[model samples]
Target: MLDANLKTQLQGYLTRLQQPIELVAALDDGAKSAEVRELLDEIVALSDKITLREDPTGSARKPSFVVQRVGQPMGIRFAGIPLGHEFTSLVLALLQAGGHPPKVDADVIEQIKALPGKYAFEVFISLSCHNCPDVVQALNLMAVLNPNVSTTMIDGALFQNEVEDRQIMGVPAVYLNGELFGQGRMTIEEIIAKLDTGAAARDAEKISAKEAFDVLVVGGGPAGSAAAIYAARKGIRTGVLAERFGGQVMDTLGIENFISVKATEGPKLAMALEEHVKEYGVDIMNLQRASALVPVDGGIEVKLENGAVVKSKTVVLATGARWRNMNVPGEAEFRTKGVAYCPHCDGPLFRGKRVAVIGGGNSGVEAAIDLAGIVAHVTLLEFDSQLRADAVLQKKLRSLPNVDIIVSAQTTEVTGTDKVNGLKYKDRVSGEEKRIELEGIFVQIGLVPNTDWLKGTVNLSPRGEIEVDAKGQTSLPGVFAAGDCTTVPYKQIIIAMGEGSKASLSAFDHLIRTSAA
Candidate 1:
């Protein structure tokens, strides 16, 4: 049943429809069918532009719903009730059916249209997975725009047998033309890049810089974008080089900690970041990786992996960081098999099954708490004497009956022949070994900075973080650092952005002094 507030919100959303939408619910003698019918009824009552009809041909195994405009089929179907985070997917599909094109660029649309063959996408999803909506929306838009493409959204819980048959261990597990496409949340460009052969290399052109810039930002994450904006504001030539924009933020699920905004997802925030940076006169170089940095007489020569070279008077390193692995036996062997890093993407695959979470930091603890509701049992292991999560999160975890926390424990192995079946751990103080039988494992220890390319070119901490000062200045002059790649105490979106602005301003200060001298 829809709550009063939710009903009001749905009504408001549907009132903005540009065209009438028709929902066809296929039902059978099943509990889910009746539930879906009732929900559609409620939704249909919200606005005059929406209507619903029922079909009794659906089987008990998979009752489906098809969304269309007036009498035109949109080729968008849902094999199960689109509840939880998937509600957003249904809303977007309806909007697309109402004649609204996707928010993608025209060039991207043309690229997708240029594909030669027909493609079918089957996207597996969990209701609670925040990342699934983006994947589903991107594919749905593709299906809507192209005549040769079709898309379906499958609820992982309702169709457990199919999920197990496919060995699907993650939400947003996309299947293209009956074969595994990819998993997790990805941009529209990324999806098309995989389908279009030679697309990756062809779509990305070599970045060429003819003249030097006063400031060159090394990454396009929050910090680098902020730095680029600030540097460009100084009325000087500024450029940004990114292997891929958005960095670690692209991996985030829901972001509530970022100040000002009440709530936003990783991909959405990343889009906004790119758009905000584009607002300035900064030279944004995408899909370009900095392989080496050489300090020149008055500036640094940045060498890209594509062999392109660019000169800059100053540089800001915001290369960002990646997830740290357990490094234990079978951990790497079972990656995406039964081991996963993203809790939102793979948590549902382990529903009603046992799983273990490695590390007891904020990320690990949060993963345990989030997974506890989806998985049958959660065993959290920490190498330290106590949990490092916030007190509030720790309290919430304690209240969950299906969660177990072990401190001063060391993970020895992720045991499995084909898929993860169990984990071996050691009690550091008691010198006792223990084994916990589980179907999946989630590791969230920490992040390793992406500063391998900057090795020896600039001073780095023993931990591989770029060494920076109070003003975001690195060990070398005319160089600065920000975000997770730097020696900053805390790594947060707001903090990185603040540091980025500081570093850009510092670069401008250096240029001003140099010009005067």
Candidate 2:
């Protein structure tokens, strides 16, 4: 039910409307003032063109509009945020509010859906957080598909108290019966499994750690896989947790520099490495993420968002960094075709073609140098006043026969019809604009630390890199951070792998000391 202030506002509108007015995300929140009403009216007129799902029961209301009618009481309900994973939840809430009982699949899903029957569920999420939205939408869908379900969302930013009271911890935390219990990204299937837990009991089953491992590695990148291999070899029961079977290394199209392998694709090398580590009896938890880390015994306990926590003696955080995006218009539309982050992955596809490299730093110049040898021509554009690379590298780049360096120039647009055929540039000084024809664009604008989740928990450099000792030991005992994400520089596959192995050894030594004590 809406509070008094909100109820009065809704009632005033109910009196003026002829038919039921459709409610939408923008309108229900009072963001639509009189000035925006006309614009909204136009959008509503085109609503039929928009596709919508139907619920046999009205409890799951469609988002076309929220209605206030004559002689109607001003009772209101909130539909939680629909953006990110919560978007699916918004649909579910509308279904329940309109009067339909959504049939749940997994016993776990139903268990979560059938909260304590008192508090509402509010989940906040962002699209940037990749896996955060799934958990919320699963709950919302279950809530809407069921009659007794009446969940709603509060503005996460505005309703800080609501979040705290519910112990809303992170970007994607769920309020169950209006209480904060556990937070992490959960899939519909996983939630359903949780809801359907224990057909014998009609509720979710709670279990303790399977408790058979020491070090659990997260990510199958060079660091993670290497940690698993080393830990297992040292006679420590170990497991590897990776979102993808192979991390970014597998996505890397080419690697001419890994020792002994001469030239190979990142995926090929990762596959071979995967086989090598398996021989050592390392258990791989592929296609998964670490959802919770509970401290226990000699190390911390590891819990996956899939609702399974394993007991371990130590944890190695090796989650690698993701590619940076330009965030400009159409950059996403033509990513692999015209705009590329991994030059080695798609560089061969652009053989004898014209390409542009954005960034004036080491990566930018290195990519320019690499592509120059294969492409017809390479244009290196730098936004900085001057290239800040080392003199030796700068001289080497200048000497490249096919390279052209454009400094103090800003790229305004990556212009093309379907694929990247040209790029638009602006002169910071002369204010002149020029468009150059190119088939490819590689961006190396620097790297952002993917260690935001570990601040006070781990020692980090001023630049946010995880601080590792010579042996990859973090300040906190038993908590090891590795890979390009950490302080180790020269972000190459081999270096990250070596660091991972070292960290695993460090963790093993720490465990051994504790066990002997």
Candidate 3:
């Protein structure tokens, strides 16, 4: 249900529509369709400028709806129930169809208009992806502004077959004109460049896998870049492949713990990292994702998803990890607004405000203690009956005057309007649901390694992390693992960089010893 103030505000915005918009819902007789219909009915009833046309001719395969103005298709379509974070997508579509233009840069709009050919942008996204909305909204805006373009927003969860067909493991996996474009967060300018050049399209000379290297580094994160620089300095034929340089660090809002650098944003740091790596003689393969790694004669072979392969005498796995999400309601909706993952990156933003930290692990306790010094209050919520953090960390957390710890508390939902205002949690013992008012929620629930591709090629821990020795040596002789993807005790950027350096040096040592043999 819409709040009185919010509904009134929306009505004011809707009343100013330049034209009448029609919502043609292609729905079958199902619960999903019924739910969507009810939502649409409420929206259409808000203003006479909008109308709803229900069509029971929807394919049973997938439920969808279309928006049109003056009988002209705006190329805006929704394949699933636009709930949570996706609710914004629905509102933007309606507004665009009502003759309201998107708030994109004028220069970017001109660039989109000047695009050579018609581009069908199929942006596959997950509701929980914090970065997907921006991409989706940008592409949808391009479609609205240019009749030569069309856009479709596909919910990956609902369309599992398409996700499998495309082999999309990350969110915001975009495809342009039936070819895999790219994934993750990208600016409008970057998207335009990719669109103009058909960035993924390669020539035989570019993607023909005839090249071999002494050392190959997969991933372009802090660890991978460090490895490439170190290996290149050894005067070896080193190469690095990445879907996008910067990796998880690119998503970080602010980085203050990277040594020497007092404060910096993720994109700035990513650019600096790429520039530094480029200073070396390393062969860089940008926008490439390794799909498989196998042993070859006297070396290892790496196969990319784009049908490119490269053989290397030694390999360094620097693929980083992603933060584990809460996967609860309102969590995704307030992402980047009030729900954050990296405490060091986003904790300062909540200064002098009450915040909650989820999980009872070391990460969560550490975040709560760190935040206690800055924020007005810190509430630590743990799902387990007992805290799993180290004794020292638990002691420090308990000593904090502004920190309150709660055990056996399950976070059910993140509640807010525009921004996070509160959270809902259930007590495991008492079986009572309670609401806590807080401005922000930090999710410190461990990490998931990006080493799923190297599952059989290397030995993995029961926790799914790649097992590595102190020398950064993996189960395989020629293959080394580093960074958060490996069994590194610490998951800091500096530690990952150091591990990457060790792996590269180890690879070089292997090379020298093998040649001597």
Query: lDDT per model, in order?
Result: 0.86, 0.63, 0.81
Clashes of 3: 0
As a TM-score, model 2 comes out at 0.52
Candidate 2, residues 12-61: lDDT per residue as tens digits? 43343323324442332244223234333433343232122222243342
Error of 2 at 437 (Å): 5.9
Per-residue C-alpha lDDT of model 3 across residues 1-517, encoded as one tens digit per residue = 5667766777877876788999878877778767778778878889898988866574343567777785787777777777655677778878887888767658678878888778888887766555677687778777877788877888776777876565454567788889878766776656886776654445223765557899999989989999999999888898988777888877765578989999986766887888899889778777677889989889998888767777899999988988888899999888755787766545545657899999999878988987898789999999999899999999999998999899999999999877889999999999999999998899998889988888888999987899998899998989998998998887888888899999999999999999899
The residue pairs that clash in candidate 1, if any, are none
In model 2, the runs with Cα more than 4 Å from the true position are 1-209, 253-256, 291-298, 305-307, 333-337, 344-354, 360-377, 385-403, 412-440, 446-449
Model 1 / residue 56 / CA error / Å: 5.7
Candidate 1 Cα lDDT to native: 0.86
Model 1, 31-139: lDDT tens digits are 9888888888998899898899876663334478878888777668888888788888888887788776677779789987887898888999988777788888888
Candidate 1 vs candidate 2, lDDT winner: 1
Rank order (by TM-score, best first): 1, 3, 2
The regions of model 1 sitting more than 4 angstroms off are 4-21, 46-61, 70-72, 203-206, 209-214, 253-268, 281-288, 294-312, 395-400, 430-432, 515-517
Question: Alpha carbon lDDT of residue 476, candidate 2?
Answer: 74
* Alpha-carbon RMSD to native, per candidate: 2.9, 17.1, 13.4
